[model samples]
Target: MRGIDLFLTLVVMLSLGAVLWPFLFYPLILRMLTTRPEQPGQGQPPSASLLFCAYNEAVAMPEKLANLAMLKRRHPQLQILAFDDGSSDDTAALIAAQGDLVTLVQGPGRSGKAHGMKRLAVRARGDVLIFTDANVLLDAEAIDNLLARYADPQVGGVLGSLHYLGEGKSATASVGSLYWRIEERLKDEESRTGNVLGADGSIFSIRRALYPDFPDSVLDDLTVSMAVIFAGKRLVKAKDVIARERLVAARGDEYRRKVRIAARAWHTHGHLRPQLRRMSAIDRFKYASRKIVRWFGGLFILTGVMAAFALALRIAPLLAMVGVTLALILLALGLRSKGGPVAAVVDILIAYAATLQGVFKAMSGRTVTVWNPAKSR
Candidate 1:
């Protein structure tokens, strides 16, 4: 019994520590690291290719391109390319309607985002490649801001700050939005330290030469940014170049999106490990702490809860009660948008089950190549 008690306590401590490390220790350590100012914007603005990947995004593409066109007018040297990844909808027709103003790559059929991006990359003929999603509205000066950072010469990529707009007044939207706020801040800190782990797919720019036509199974932004890091180049965060998109309002949709992303993350990591191993000790540590730990952080929380319960059974009932209470509070906060306590609890449980399913799929070597665009907010 004594042995069991000690073991359970240690397990609980370690598990909970994993959960708290990113929220507490990770940020604290980064804050302590002196903030490095970005290299000043230099030379002429690099000729840029504004690239877009679309699949069944007809409803949003027209508006998105209008914004891009405006951007093109501002920067006469900018080239625009749109790849329609075999959308069944009128996506191809819409791109065609843009005339010669935009180059359209309508592939054979349903190849997926990675393939679409690959096609776009081959067609892109610019010093810089600006990748934007079909739903994002880019600011007119986004390209200028991103290009300025490239003056440092060391920076291989620039990740733009993307904010969520129109997250309804729902409690769930607020929670999701707040979570992004925390995530973005952490990313900024990572950038300041000169070791950002990934870029946002919504809007980011990379030196054309550094771009890798990564495998279709890999997450584009992560692999691209990490590829830059692997080559001994810097990936900086450009908060001034902003883009806005609607938050995922439906809980089910949000859960599915997270699970799909989590599975892809697991797949991508296998390909990343070899590159990561060759990195400097500090770079390796930062990647593990920032990416690896966060990827499996949910598991840590799960383990902590189980260990706490086991400890409570053997040693203190209050331990289990406290764990349950905290969990209930979290569930309550998560459910605030879903309506009552019962619905929120149900959604939380569903989310957990979905997460477990995603992990299992990942472990089984399954990958989600096809994707459904989540319903707009």
Candidate 2:
């Protein structure tokens, strides 16, 4: 029993390390070894479509439309399309008000983002499809920068960086903002080496010809990125292209978003596993090591907790107590720290807690039906 406890603890710790090291450390190593490639010429720009899916987003419609108009001015050939997903608000009317400047799609009811995207895709006339969220403000050069990456035939998709606006309004929002920046840096490094695991929904561009239709329940951006990767095309990140948005200010907003994301990720795992066997050994290893383990981190945490409890009763009570004490101290420090090293530590703890919650919910056979939309940050 003692041997079993020790072994389980070791396994849990190693699994945690394997899951986080690639995303947090390998990127830094890649940056040291890589140099940015020269920018490709903007030579005849490809026809592109700007796609936005709005659900009760009337409050943001005016600014979103103005931003699209600005983008059209820069890229004269760009076409804009907006979808209203059974919004209870004035979103449909707002899109209709834009007239020819934007093509409007209305749905009988809310079918979620994946359905809206597919509907827009069917109507898209551009060779390149760029998807942006209603809440994001795209920089004037965002589309130009995104399309420029297609100059590399090896690159099939490009993901843009998201800058969190209004971050300083609250501590939670500030922490979220910092977390996003760290994520972007890690993704940029992953792209420099080869392929990014996935892209944010706010700003990612893909070839319309390569787009795959996915179930509405799955996370649309992740499904799109994985589909492209499984097709043997590279999905790269465009750090120069920026989309800015405010952090959702509410405390529970992040928690709700994480839960839905965890559920979708769990679902996507099975869908993506069959394709993994066909990928290069490096990619296969990277995906399993970095992504698969993290998805199961909550299980490991529970295992670790169980092992600690068993070991305390059977053998080293003092050591077990010390370990628990240390964990509490770390968590407390994390909660009190501003958005820096301490806050980052807190983010990790919060992430771990959320992961644990997801695992518990899954184990209890609880169907996660309540889709709490993320607060705009």
Candidate 3:
């Protein structure tokens, strides 16, 4: 009942609220604000360019090239562009062997995906540019679905739904898959209410003219997609326009991937600060809720738990120790990386820690521009 205790309790509450706001309340708020379902307009398919940047993706090249071949056959005019990021593997050769199927651009060195994408974008002559990963496979109708959205002049971009192939394979995969599902739901809501904030590289498309030049350190998908909103156009998600990729099942690989992604995301936030400020109030709310707040999740959870433990200690030292012991036990169980509730919680905590590491790296002006495809994925 002391003022200091009350203040500590209040801090704990606020921290918890900030941490959970994005994951829990944000969706509910979106549901309240969401308008009628978004529907694509009717029209002939747009002239489209499929662009992807690859780094040492030889393992997936054969299947990927075949997929692209199928797409090219489906839409004969679809311009397919590929950038080889100075790979030591046969990636360039494989892409080159396809000859005209893919307009292959070889980078001088490891310039990175963003740099390669910029190069591809410049050469792309299509009306709409579709960006995706080398390993991600799109549904047969994904291109048609994506192109149909641009029938509405107000539609500047469309994000495709991504499904993970290995959800229950491991604790890490399960949590990652579940987290992705929640993200998709949020994107759906964001699309219905307004712009979907940003897009992922797995599958998304934008008007070719709206492609904005950005630094290599920033996340290209997010930067390019958000520009559509900045251009006063809707960036909606089409559930039928789907892409599929395997989840990184190994704990270490997934952790490193999240860390790399988070770090670049934070760096991108810093770069886009001015433009982000110019967004509509509602979009600003969505960005802050869905992105800014979630990035600090690790810090919030740490702060809240420490404050709660301190308050509990002030009340009863034995009870505080008991609670701490129980938490540590659960964390140890999670560290084993087996599938279960305890392991899932541990996996989430580890993810938060990785993300926090990434955010801190961005704060320290360190970022990951170049990347190798996750092997376990």
Q: What is the lDDT of residue 219 in candidate 2?
A: 66
Residue 1 lDDT (model 3) = 66
Candidate of highest TM-score? 3
Residue-level lDDT tens digits of model 3 in 207-264: 9989998998899988999999888888999999999998998888988898999999
Estimate the lDDT of model 1.
Answer: 0.79
lDDT of 1 by residue, 1-377 (tens): 78988898899899878867876788898888887676666578788898878888888877887897899788877889988888889888988998667899987887777888888988899999988888899888788888888888888888899899865544445556766787789889989987687776888888999887578988776787788888888888888999988777677787888788778877888878888899877677777787677666668868877887887867768876887898787766656646554544545455445556676678899978667787745
Ranked candidates, highest TM-score first: 3, 1, 2
Write one digit per residue (lDDT tens) for candidate 2, span 1-377: 65776786686676556555656655555667555453465456678998988888878878888988898888878889888888887878988988878999987786777788889999999988999998899998888888888887667788999998888765567767766887788777767767778777889988888898666666678888777788878888988899988787555676667666676666656556677678776566557645666667666666766755665655777887887888789778767765556656566556666765764565454424224345454
Question: What would the TM-scores of all predictions be?
Answer: 0.90, 0.84, 0.97
Number of colliding residue pairs in each model: 0, 4, 0
- Which stretches of candidate 2 lie above 4 Å from their native place? 1-12, 28-43, 305-347, 356-372, 375-377
